[model samples]
Target: MTLKNFKVLGILLLLLAVFAVGGKKVSAAVEDRDVQYTIGVVVYNQNSPEMNMFMNYYREYIQQGFPVKFYFSGSINSAEDEINFIRAMKLQGVSGIISFYGQDIQKIVEACDEEEMYYVLGSGSISDEDYDKVKTSPYFLGSVGPDAKADYEAGYNMADYFADADTSSYIVLTGGSSAGNYMHLQRTIGVLEGLAEKEGLTYSEDVEKLASSEKTTVVDAGKDNVSITICPGYMTDPKGINNLKHAFVDRNYDAVLCTFNVDEIMKTITSKEEEQGSNIKVGAVDCFSMENHDEINDNDSFGNPKIDYIAGKYASMGGPAFAILYNAMSGHPEANTDDADSNTVRLYQGFWSASDKDTFNELYGYTQDIYENAYSCADLMKVIKAYSTDTTPDDLKALTEAYTVEDVQKRIEEN
Candidate 1:
């Protein structure tokens, strides 16, 4: 009896040891498998200041903690280019993609679904038709971008700033004309509306009316003493820039309103000021870098700051997009249950306007500090985890609504 009992006990102990070791090996294999996936980022322009700032925060605060690697496609200018970029990224074996360019949303979403890759929009909105078509795709994770109404409000506010400064005559720079440049068009329309309201001026023709015409430039607004010239084209258009310079030289307008390429136009204005000794005020929309901040705060010969107002995108646009893509890839997708289709579209409002130096300094200073200290890779992962299945679309919206410097600082502090 004693010998048999001892043999049974010895056999049981050996089996338990074998199972324990095998379980550990299986766990190790799963963890190793998690590290094999990759994410591809599609950016319109690699050299853009805003995109550069976004990538810096992405690498520091999001990419580091993730087990996946990152790949960046070259600049995409059109819808066809974006589709081609997605196909290439699929070929490279990316598990998911975050695209900054949102043109041809339906086609892009279809391509991602066909390739079995998760897709998230980094910025920009899709049309209603496109939304209806692709919103239910399992591969379409969703999108985050500047809200259209908020963008229009920013444009209105800036135009109001110029009018309050008593700007009577000005030239407006509208960036791009294609569907991809929809944001620019919204801002341009808002600027015209604001000017017409505050100055009692009226546009003979609107952007839509003028867009179809052969006229690229229009004297669209006029009152007894107030007038505005609108120029619609690409920011990097040499011909357009030259035409703007010629108009400025001839008329010596009171101000210049730029919807994009603020830095380039600022340089042009400074050159004109140096040559003709004219002090022209500027109101622009772009990311606020240290260099731009210095320019905004600098005084001309008459002791007046050259830049009156600036509306900027936050530095960490990539953070929320990464969270969306990561969540979908990790098998917990954020869905919009309120919509009839029960599909998700994560819209983030990201327009911060500062008219005074103190406001700009506070906003910029806190943002820099967060990037350097408070929000790390681990912190970003925690935020992404907050988007678990139990979380609602409102919850996801709250996470991305932290658009201001103060909002971001509070989130970091809470983390």
Candidate 2:
């Protein structure tokens, strides 16, 4: 060959070698990531901002450099569909799943068993029967979220604070049987338990336990003891606010307890006030909006009188979910992964009260923060890395067990 041709040939060979090396490096990185494992997320609906924030954080911090994929079963409506979705994820060779179903968990457990895929429950607690059945599955990781019991504790704590010094009757408002979702039931139960624990309080078991009464002793013997009674109005619909208003107006109650949605509850109370000039003390759970805060502050709807009031709706689920899902994907099996009832399930700090704006800010400041900037995605990623590969059930348990109430409190405080 001529000298010029040989030189051209040599340059072309050099370029080919460089391209070959670069391709191998890229392939190696992809292999290292193991992105082949898809993670299925089954939420009641995909439209909630909270869910979006979580998934965004997961993508940015946990999956950016990783090879994990996410398959979301948006707006799961029925048990059979839920089971089918789990099976579909298994078909996709998903490494695991993170879910929060509105209905039952048995379908989820049974589906996981058939697929042999690792799973973690969030948002919903399992029934006793299902808990027993799924507690031994290696594929079932521990759950983490704000549970029903915590919600009830918060509700009762608010009631105690508002009624502690007053000797007057109060008004209570409920969303009726429709609001008897497991979470609401837990919160209501907690309130009842808290009231029962306090001295001088008795609930009429027959009247749906909506209200209670007690007589307070005055220091002056000449003065009579004041009889405080609580009367509750049940709202099955928004128009039921009229019924609630009538119940409060006709009855001799002092304060109002709203064990339902903050926005709707606030609207009903305000509407009633405008209609009948009522000033009932109100207490509710999960009132996070600024408008809700202003209404509580400006109005007498027995505003959150204590620190842990109105249990911060869904904001408490973010940190624990990041930690748990990471643990599952990293292959570190949690001991309680199999036992849904174990304390290993992380309980994140919720905005327990709305008595003060600053207090509210302390527990949850996300209302003002950007999705990505609000929390540490990298820290979440580290936890996932620990659990992604070569994970054992004991390892999973240890990690979950490490997340105690004290730890969560500290984390909440630090953040």
Candidate 3:
């Protein structure tokens, strides 16, 4: 053989050795791809029961399949805090984020966009103006939350429940300041509208004025025999509990309506009723727990429920939010569809309600069949996988539409 032929064979041999060594590393990287992708979760309060439930479910059921590590932000309150947390996550090699609360959404979106990290809004929503600003941003993976109108409707439903219970005289307690949380404001408006629509009910002109102001107001609903008083204020404030106790518990209102912080109100009313033998029925929104359910469903010594009705509690938004984030990170974003605009916002309806022990058990009792079948990780993963397939927004919406125990039962049976 010629010297040139011998050199050519040596070059080929060198190239073959290189491929053998490099191919193993490349294959190993492909197999471990999920390990490199970290997801940051910006939870409002990591210790909250809702957040606990979400994390527990995600780690136990979802993480095994997805194989991604999660970094949690500590109790974020402000937009600046959230942005700093996001930047820190980005620096730490986080590829995607799911934010449970962001008061300053525009800045958060901008920061995520600058970092080229995917962001999914979980359990909260951005304002229309902020959404419009970030609608076109590739980093904004979209939002998953309860419909804003549903908040108003939740208030309306609570009022209607009270009206149906023959509650002629009652008081209303709001959760937070109107300027701080628009959802609370919308719900407060809904409650007023519902009360105004009830037959044989008349509220003071100041009740109508609640649409403009967040101050607590006493609106008289009934005349002589039936009287209703509506008071609105932030439940988190130190003065809020005192005011609520004075207006509802001390004054012995027949019933109480609370749009936010239902747990605090419920506990206060329960304590007051236990001490004073008051039988004030309670209606509230966003208070769904085993204890809250028992309080609402169990009868007192006199055989009447301490609390009456609750709406919008069983709505677990974290599942959908996680699905959105996972899809975006996996390169199968639901927003990529022709029918879904990149800026499209997904809204889930509130459907859970408990009027009696049977219904309460069916909804909140851990041993119940509905509870047994409630939203498994596999079930949620189905929705996540659908984003890349033929699934439409309507199909996606259907997955979250049935939030009540009965509705969930029917959905499970149908499927």
Candidate number with greatest TM-score: 1
> Taking the tens digit of each residue's C-alpha lDDT, what string does model 2 give over 157-275?
76676657362444444444233455555555555555455534554352223322121111111212323233233343445556555564564444555666555455655555555
Task: Give the Å shift of residue 308 in candidate 3.
Answer: 2.2
Can you write out model 3's per-residue Cα lDDT over 196-249, one digit (the tens) per residue? 787556656654365435555555555676655546566656666666766654
Worst 10 residues of 1 by lDDT: 22-31
What clash count does candidate 1 reach?
0
Q: lDDT: which candidate is best?
A: 1
Clashing pairs in 1: none
Q: What is candidate 1's lDDT per residue for 207-253, written digit by digit as tens? A: 45543222346465656588677766665677667767766666667
> Rank by lDDT, descending?
1, 3, 2
Give the alpha-carbon lDDT of every model: 0.67, 0.50, 0.64
- For lDDT, candidate 2 versus 3, the one ahead is 3
TM per candidate comes to 0.81, 0.63, 0.80
